[model samples]
Target: MKKKLLVFTGSPRRDSNSAILAVEAARAARKAGASVEVINLSRLRVNPCRACDRCRDRGPGQCVQKDDMKKIYPRLQQAEAIILAHPVYWFTINAQTKLFIDRWYAFGADEYRCFKDKKVGLILTYADQDVFSSGGVNALRAYQDIFSYLGAEISGMVYATSAGPGQVKKNKTALKEAYNLGRELVS
Candidate 1:
């Protein structure tokens, strides 16, 4: 069966650097014979987790709050690979990405082991080139930890340094790497 890849972009800005790389990655994944679905969190109505633990009581994949997340749960469960694209803000992922990830707690509560062995990728954009000074390193580590906790393996990652709009377009190396990362997820 062909692999299914889910690409989630957490940038609120249209045509963001991270989104550009994500689009490239998705295209490459499709070329590599994987069915790809791209989800732009900014266009969705996902809400922050309320920490009610209702998913725990209601069984796996259950959440008390009714919102757009209902549409994402099934996709998350069915994906063979997952790619998270976002910008580093204040040494961590942006609010949208963070909220979407927190909602995964619902899956965790149900002991949803379907994600085990699935491949995961990350595309991060930052203005600062220095890892320590920019906090990009911390964001990368956080993504690694989260994927690990979810029982997924890191397929690859691309960190693109871009300060202004469309800056990533000039970064041919980063773009190629992002595309390769997507291809690797399917391999």
Candidate 2:
């Protein structure tokens, strides 16, 4: 079977810098012979996790709140690699991305074994060059912790700095790195 890659964009703005990078990554993944799916969190109706613990009690991949997240669950399960692309808001991932990730608690709580050994990649765009924008290195560290907890292998990451709308396109280095990261995940 062909490897499946799922790319999730957390940018709420259409054509945002993060989204552009994500598209590039997805394109490269496709070229590398992986089936790729790109999902925009902004277009989804995912809600915050209510901490209901129903999924834990019911079983793995089960959540009480029926929303667009239901659609995400199946794709996530089927993916061999997962890519998260987002712009930094106050030195962290945007609110939309956070909310989407938070809902993954259901899978985490249930100890879903599907996530184990799955490849994970991160594409982050930030306006600041400073590492201490929101406490020192918190965003990357937080994502690292989450991926580790899920038992996913960190395939690669790209941190594109000084990225504003249309700015990331000019950063040839970051774009190349993002594309390479995608290719690496499938390889």
lDDT of 2 by residue, 104-157 (tens): 888966586878999999988877775566322677899889888888898888
Clashing pairs in 2: none
Residue-level lDDT tens digits of model 1 in 141-183: 8877887787789988899789887899999999999999989
- Candidates' C-alpha lDDT: 0.88, 0.85
Query: Candidate 1 deviates by what RMSD?
Result: 1.1
Instruction: Give candidate 1 misplaced runs (Cα > 4 Å).
Output: none
Q: Report the CA-based lDDT of candidate 1 relative to the real structure.
A: 0.88
* Per-residue error (Å), model 1, residue 76: 0.4
RMSD of each: 1.1, 1.6
User: Using alpha carbons, what is the TM-score of model 2?
Assistant: 0.94
Model 2 gets an lDDT of 0.85
Check candidate 1 and list the clashing pairs.
60-110
Best by lDDT: 1
